[model samples]
Target chain A: MRMIPAYPVRSVLVLLAPCLVLSLWLGMPSLVHPATPEEIGLKIATEASARDDGFGNFTATQAMVLRNKQGQESRRQLRVKVLEVTDDGDKSLMVFDEPRDVKGTALLTHAHKQEADDQWLYLPALKRVKRISSSNRSGSFMGSEFSYEDLSAPEVEKYTYRYLRDEPCGKLTCTVCERFPVDKKASGYSRQVVWQDKDELRTWKVEYYDRKDSHLKTLTIGNYTQHLDRYWRAGEMTMVNHLTGKSTVLNWAAYQFRTKLKERDFSKTGLKRAR
Target chain B: MRDGAARYALALTTIWLAASVLAVEAHAEIEFAAWELSGRVSLESRYFPRTGIDPSHQSSNTNGFVLEPKLYVEDVEGRSVTVLPFFRYDSADPVRTHWDLREAYVLLFGELGENEWEVRLGADRVFWGVTESQHLVDIVNQIDFLEHPNGKVKLGQPMVHVTWTADWGVLEFFGLPYHRPRIFPGQGGRLRFAGLLDNERVEYQSGAEEWHPDFAARYSHSFGPLDIGVSVFDGTSREATLVCVPPACNPREISDLSNVLIPYYAQIRQFGLDAQLTLGAWLFKLEAMHRSGERNALGLQQESNATELRGIGFEDILGLYREEEYVAAVVGGEYTFYSVFGSTADIGLLAEWNYDERGRQALPRRQPLTLDNDFFFGALLAFNDVESTEIKVAFLTDASRATRTLAAEFDRRLSDQWSLHVESSSILSMDPDDIQWVGRRDSFFEFHLEYNF
Candidate 1:
């Protein structure tokens, strides 16, 4: 202390105090080392979400193809309209177009950040709107391998994330992480391992673990296309069930953005008016 | 008379079509799409294990075929037209072999400055209620009884419906012009009464008869977790009160007293409220209604006091068309277990309590059939398989009447365009003194195969 200059020592400690506080706030291991796994995982997820902000609204068509263990195939088609909410989760209206039996059925959902979503169903045969419980998120969607929870928009508040490692995913370097659902009592999975590309933070694949920590299913997303030069969307998503040897493939088409959709377009009345 | 009613309906439809065409022509430069055609055909087979209480009604098996075709067109100007025609042919029951226009409507919906509005002019179906066991607030459409004993089917109602959406709630107003008479089973039909119902001698409390104009209004809104609706209806009652005039049923004689029951329609005013609250995995539903101007059991005594027709001691069928008031309610909840036992399937347990002020003493069809002071418990199993399979089983019991019924319904998709449905109901035990004792031998199993395009 006597050998060093007093002014230099005072200035260095003054600057290092804020850094030390910020590092601790961010849960970093040390100043010389990288951030802790939790910080890195959150950073990746937050950045990935930031990349998809301010889309306004969109409309798309999806054809779901389901295949059983014996190679039997069933098909369903639906049209989806989405509206972005500034301070909350998005709102969506999905209307079935194929599977003639339920042709005019529509589902409307208003997702929330820290609470259960609000859902309503329009039954064309009854010409009535029914408010449905959203707690059945783990149940299969339209008998497909994809559950309702899997199809919903993933908000950062719904899960807790942890970083695993950085590894090579195909030709691109990727960050592997794990996330546990916030609603542990309602979720069917204990945790999910995700692989996301480093450059654009595009999710490449996901593996789901059941409550008992057994591998349950794997989801692979491919054919990424960028819209508006800012948003990356997957054209194909395949979910395979390991326990039942069944799989469902969702083929998306006609991706449109900024469709001038309003909040009233996602209301209960809108559900009945959907074609 | 039936033919005349059909002609009147056709004339009204033609006039509406002409008016809509003129309206469309007034809108310049709006292109409409070509008419699209779609619909379904169904083949059904129903079997009864026990013979009917009436010896003459001996048909234990029957076959039916249905054809429903739809035509639709829409324009970019928020205008659309839908036409659906339905026809069915029953092998055993002549009344079941009938045809009707299920839907034929012109819908125009758009925004008015800051508000949204929709107008639908023509025949349509509107259903309102939250409870599953009994739809107390659903008073818009007339039930198609001959289509199913469960009364799930409805005939198209001719109306001019308008809906206005505001920041507060949605307000819907309906102007219904015509009433569809409830159809009954023929003598050969399994679910028919002890004798044939003479529809040719139908009576109405309103002098306007079947031509009486009806009005209904509903206001619905949704809060954070609750959706509620309040409705008011002023119209002819859909359920007919049967008046046995002369030569009433003798307790000793079990047959040959036909054409004595006259179906009477009453003008009524009904106020209803339905609400559903969703919390976590639980859904609570309530539907309550207060209706006036329908006959009750007490009216039977009033009839004997005023009319020349003496009461034949058949208290169930001899109620006079007197103005009476009553209240009914169905309160229930459903709790669902998602992915139980580590499977993708879901199971829901449902329980409902049905209450009627008139209780069991009220005549049949005055309130919900078989639901006066009753408890219903049910379980729904959704396989969530590739076939979209589902099964629902329910149990209904009335302690006062000592009656019990068990029913099961199953449906699955055979393919994208094909489906199959099966339903069975069994009356395990019933009190002979109960009004519904005639249905003791009415247990049946039904199968339906449908093809859609």
Candidate 2:
């Protein structure tokens, strides 16, 4: 207003010159060459495997809906409480909310590479918990369209992967990768191919093959929403059976991770009387 | 002499032709067979005071045992086949001749144009229901309640059947006319034919037994995270027509003759719906059924003295009567969880409600009334894998003054194929005023060693 910044403007410009130069110098390497599809795909896979939420313990509530091609639908409300989630691994319990009476029942899984994962389901009606075998993981979970194999957290070591190519996916370029199941006896699929966004490393689609090498199903994940600045998760996953013409869609809501929880909260004594 | 020789030569030629035909039929070979064997046993003990208030003056003891074995074999040659089978059983007490030949039969399978078909002349479990539980449906083996009451057990008989399968569905026709020791009269001694269709979204079956033609259909779909299904059936069973009617000349005497015997002339209808959903860490399931029927013989039992005094009129008295209608419904669900505190733990909860009503055309003056109302709840918790060691407890109540039962069970897997199981059930009458001590008692226990192959 009073010609106050004439002297200050030059001085500020002089001060910004070095900072601008430094930024340009620092960004020069990335700008010179974009990441190739293979490099980008590997980077995404590695990053997802290495991510740690730092909650040590946490809990989440979710509403799940399954829709079929015929437009029929079913819904359930679920709560998962995490007791110990370290950079190395995690342990958690889950329970159902609706139909009112079975609200407090829970399931626990302890996963380790050296041994078969230990799993158990707590039933309120029986007031007893039953151990489930790892071999039985492929069976239907409570008669839902999703099998137990679909619900369990997939450990990165469960499969081995190789980058395939760059593929145009919708309006964006995506890196495609092929994954083969490492444990042939334990897996339901012989191999799977996944497509991920080149820039963000978000997985967008996957195709699974049966043991006979026949294409079995295709799954598409969408509706990405950012959480906690660096976290992104899909809100919907649709799977279609190639041979049977049956399809299932999973709609998820209220996904959260990283809250302070403890091992004591997931104990047998705790399960018998969980609220 | 020349005439006799010519006749002998003709007979020899006929025998040779028949032998060749038999040989060709026997050599048309495609054979299939499978066998399944399962068994369970447990030990139990109980304590009850002579008086309701006296806890100290009580008595308790325990014992249990069981054994079961099953086998099946089939032979198919070209268009013809045969089957043989057997089952062995021992439970709680020892009995003579535990082994019984359960099935024996022959069949023919072939292809006509692009369609595949089969004709079977033997015995097999008739198809019915998405899930089998004798408590709810029929065609059961009468196994102990521990096993799935909803599973269909193979019961053998003499039958002739034809089946055709295509991309759209399957159609079948059958006739069974025989008898068995433990089966109801109409069930074992009747002719039956049925048709079935199975596709990705739906399944249906329809058939005629000696007394009725039955029809059933089920449709399923997925929505969001849940799977849902609906099923309906008509004319449930041939055995449902056992109610005797009084003779025209003698209203007081029960007549053995049936007034309505044509298939589907009288019918029973049932509808069911079920859903399963998973949200987060919880799994939810709901199952329900609504059934209504005409001329239901199973509900025509004679009223006991106590039931009669409970406002049941003289016209409602048992012998040889007809009911125009009846209705029943049940709903239930279960939830389960596994592992707490990093230890191998499992748990679950279940609840169900059942209601039944019977209309009164035979009850003289009283209108249709509620026959029974039942509510059931159960909870299960296990600490270790049953393969190593496990324990469980369950409670059930019938709110309509029938009976309440409390049970506990433990199982140990001694080895890869061997296991030890123990269980006990305690029954209590809600109305203490009408206690029948002998058959309806304090507790029952069982013990068993099971092996799998």
Candidate 3:
């Protein structure tokens, strides 16, 4: 009767306790030792920043194919020319290439906390550059399944996150996190839970929820390949709207970075003369 | 007019001959035009069991077809024009009559000074309401009352119209001189006319007829996301009736004419303002109108004619002057939910309240309560890339009764160029006591194959 249990819970705790303490200590480089979730999140954020800094600038060509349940299909091709990156891991201007009709389309994201991002679209048919209001970012982009909010650059400040667990995604270990959108007016989703590779920082999947707190859409990124010396980009991204029964797929290829693109290339005046 | 037609034909012949002579030289120039053809065929079969008035059973089946062909010619020497023509054939029964018509016209658009203008000289669909499915006051088309119970209005007359569009608004003027009557053929092969002057008891004088021109103006402005429009138009009367006609021995001689009295020279003048505003997920609309009819001269004439017919004095049929005015206002709103229950389920609720002032002399002064509520809920499910399903439910409630309709459709994409659709609709009423249903009660099913080019 005095024999120990086959799986001793006390021994398991003893083995995990020291490793947890050491992880906490390493996670908080700013401190000697820490145990809070925020400290680990900061460490993860720092690592993400470091990885983004190594990527510098990027330019790529992408093709998007959309298919409905009725076998209706639509395809579009776009060329992305990114200009600059900051130490905070923010991309400056990402320009488009052929089709010549949208050659001048550029997206500039000002990542900041407690403020809305400013955006603009230059329409060749109207021959005018119009400022896109921030309130409608959740609307569909050109009647596509992808929302304008999804197309915009994802800023860390736009969401508050909490690391959930370590899970296996394919052959790699992933960090699962639940993120809530800070700006209610700019997003139709109340929150999103995403899985990203721990070492590569490549996003694998995300589950989106509507304002009513219901599951709405799911996005999956796959077939990631190293674009530049340090940059890892996904070759295919698929987004599915659960309610609408619609899906959009984006396939990316031919990526290049840091070709000495100038700020003048992203100017409003230059946009009119892009083609 | 006959001589003018001959002259025009001769001139067209000369132009054709000249164009043929120059065809060889112009053969090197390649010209291309966009052409489109669309057609629709509808067949309906109905069986009504004996109810109330009818002792024996009655059933009817009808078939109709419409073909529309459009040719758009643009950038021809830097000019643009579009020609669209439509043909329709409708038959209800084998022994019943068949109606056919060529419906359409071409439009030539050009710039006059700084404003854009268009001249349309043939039968065409006129633009009036923003919502074509349900029109509150549009009265242009003479529709088949039996086939389309909701469309009791008349169609627009054939007219040559000129429209001018500017930054301010649009103005149109129509010149209509001829009145075409609808003819209905009975089983006995006798043709009967349907119009104001269709009765043989009336006589219409020749030279007394005059062309009536209708003029309308509309102005619209956009304030933020809201669009507001105000329109005014003049109501024109054109048809004249004859009371009676006597037999004539000589074919060329004029027959004996009976005294005719045209009923009420009703001239209706109307003005309306409509506004549509969108705020967030809600759409709000408001419409107000004031219609007044004056000059009851035809009523006076009818009284005098009746007195004469009865061999009475004019004083006996006096007291027939009763003018009427109508004022109505409606406000409606619709709210749409973009997402519901983690699905693309959209729900729209609409409520419209209308207040109308019935004519003072018209019967049924109680004026049925014009308040109505409509609700719609739709859901779409995509099973895969080749098949989809959609379901929609609509509920309409008025002061008289409440009706509910449910529709479901499944679409299967067979190929890149073809798709198959199956749809069904069912309707039911809320109140069993108010069961004088004029429309179809049984569900309807449709199978369609659609091809896109």
Candidate 4:
């Protein structure tokens, strides 16, 4: 009702329409220029880590099956408890249950961001606790395809990342990225390539390259389940060694989150009673 | 009388089995879930390629079987109980065929003002040492030498153990009430000394004898790359002094009584320090101890316990020892090469030096003197494979006396519940003056197959 002149209204529309069109074009996924590959890679990793943060603590039981080229299989069972640390890497305790010869053996690890981790092994037969050298990160874990480094909690500071490309993965689009390990001397691999979903940032697959830059192994993760309405956890992981014609499959079950685990429970003194 | 006692034991065992069966039937599901039963059974075969020097014990082959059953029970309130019994039957050695209560203990865990505490009651085995070449600080349990000459097996000791964990370190205190005597090989056994050694011919310096109360305490802590422990023990010495009582007093007398060896236990106070430093792929270990109130070297005109010998002047007569204080130490290091030759197997080299101030006069003269003023070199191969295989070889030698020992051991899992072990050792002595020359031909090989459930 207050409009006075049609010429003023036409001039206002002409000035605002170009600005709206320009903003829409810039926001378009196909036309927009993304941030740098390194920045994007870090951003994705950080987001993925943040989503799984604040879990406080969790416990899970794992069963591993190892197969050789001759199709012979061996099995191992273990129970793991993890405690989340707000300022540092998480703490974990693993107790073996199979291969009855070492039924009550347990391993405790205290991970750090920029320094070597602290590890201890409890031998039930001897009732002795021994501190293991953390420099053997590349050594096989329980004679499986997974190395100690592969099984450790993936802390963002332990690697340098760069975004490679995005591709279709399974039923969804995934962002591909490459990461270089920070501890070159201890790590068996020079670099690893990861494929993660764009929506929830859950990792789907990874390829490991040996120090000589040859593809050494491939790990595929699947059967993701949501916990606490926000956190996603993989139920199964399979690792295959290309050079050795060997493979190991890990099946995780009975996951309980936020079980009110205390820091004192993860101490080296508690290792003997971990059973 | 022995048959009557055996009958009585059989009846008691039958009653216990009946009661256990009744209890299981009464609380089938409730108790079954809380109680866990598991253990190992092993079959072993041994062969001696070389004949021993003792003509009386000339057996070159032997076999044995061992059974160990364990029962564990835990409650939700941080209380648990464990019971394990061990039994072995040897085909040729009577002294090696024995039964023992390996462990029967109740453990209680609790927290006190942010500090954790634990208490253990009953019989248990506690080992404390970082060095592999010698366990100088491990004195809580008596060695079961009759089982193996390498001295790795131990007898359970009755003790009241308490552990307290604080921010500074872990403190452990033990009150041991019973002392188990070391049993020597029988006449039918292979690794026997040149004597008619009998367990009945044992003496103790303390009047209280095997009932003497023993005490030990240890404080252990870890700081980054280093882990250290300081321990003190006041108890009867585990090593028995070999004494030859008169009329076996004279060294030149070839009398029948001279062939008998008496084991004498002495009271001792030992202070021990053990430490290990782990850097990269290297591990450095050291164990040192200073002991008092135990006899040292043999000397002339020494006081003897034999009343007949006391009347004469030369009481030393190879039967007397003078009590003195001495220090012993073992230091070693191991360097590992992981992922060797682009393979998953890891190889490690180890070297250790053992020093004892008493030298060749170390009280346990009847046993091999491999750790006194000797150097040990060893290699360990760990094959990180599905079978979890490992091989270890060690060589120990005394440069001055020319006494050497070469040993090798290999073990691997044959299946999920079965495993195999093979061990061999050879000894060489060039110095006839060395006591080790008595059994220079005691080289042997052992094979073991174990099943676990």
Candidate 2 wrong stretches, greater than 4 Å = A1-275, B1-27, B31-122, B125-320, B358-371, B382-392, B400-402, B430-438
Q: Per-residue lDDT for A100-175 in model 2, tens only? A: 3334468876664434555656764333444444544444443234556666655666667777888899999998
Candidate 4 clashing pairs? none
Q: What tens digits encode model 2's per-residue C-alpha lDDT throughout B234-332?
A: 543322232222221111222212221111223456665655554433445555555555443322333332242344432343332353445444456
lDDT of 2 at B37: 32
The TM-score that candidate 4 achieves is 0.88
TM-score of each: 0.91, 0.43, 0.50, 0.88
Off by over 4 Å in 4: A1-34, B1-33, B193-196, B247-258, B297-319, B363-367
Residues A1-275, candidate 3, lDDT per residue (tens digit)? 75677458778988899987976667545466544555555456546655756455666777777777775776556766555445332434545443222333665443334465444455532233433334546656433577767776566667767777899999999988777787675688888888888888888998998888888889999988876667777888899988878889988888776764444334332333232
Residue A119 displacement in candidate 1 (angstroms): 1.1
The C-alpha stretches of model 3 lying farther than 4 A from their native spots are: A1-187, A191-238, A241-246, A249-275, B1-33, B38-58, B76-121, B130-134, B139-147, B152-211, B237-267, B293-323, B359-453
Ten-residue region with minimum lDDT total, candidate 3 chain A: A266-275
Weakest lDDT window of 10 consecutive positions for candidate 2 chain B: B190-199
Stretch of 10 with least lDDT, candidate 3 chain B: B360-369
Error of model 4, residue B128, in angstroms: 0.8
- Model 4 residue B149 CA deviation in Å: 1.9
RMSD vs true structure, all candidates: 4.7, 20.8, 16.0, 6.6
Docking class of 1: medium
> First chain TM-score in every candidate?
0.89, 0.74, 0.79, 0.87
Q: Is candidate 2 or 3 superior in lDDT?
A: 3
Error (Å) of candidate 2 at residue B190 is: 31
Winner on lDDT between 3 and 4 is 4
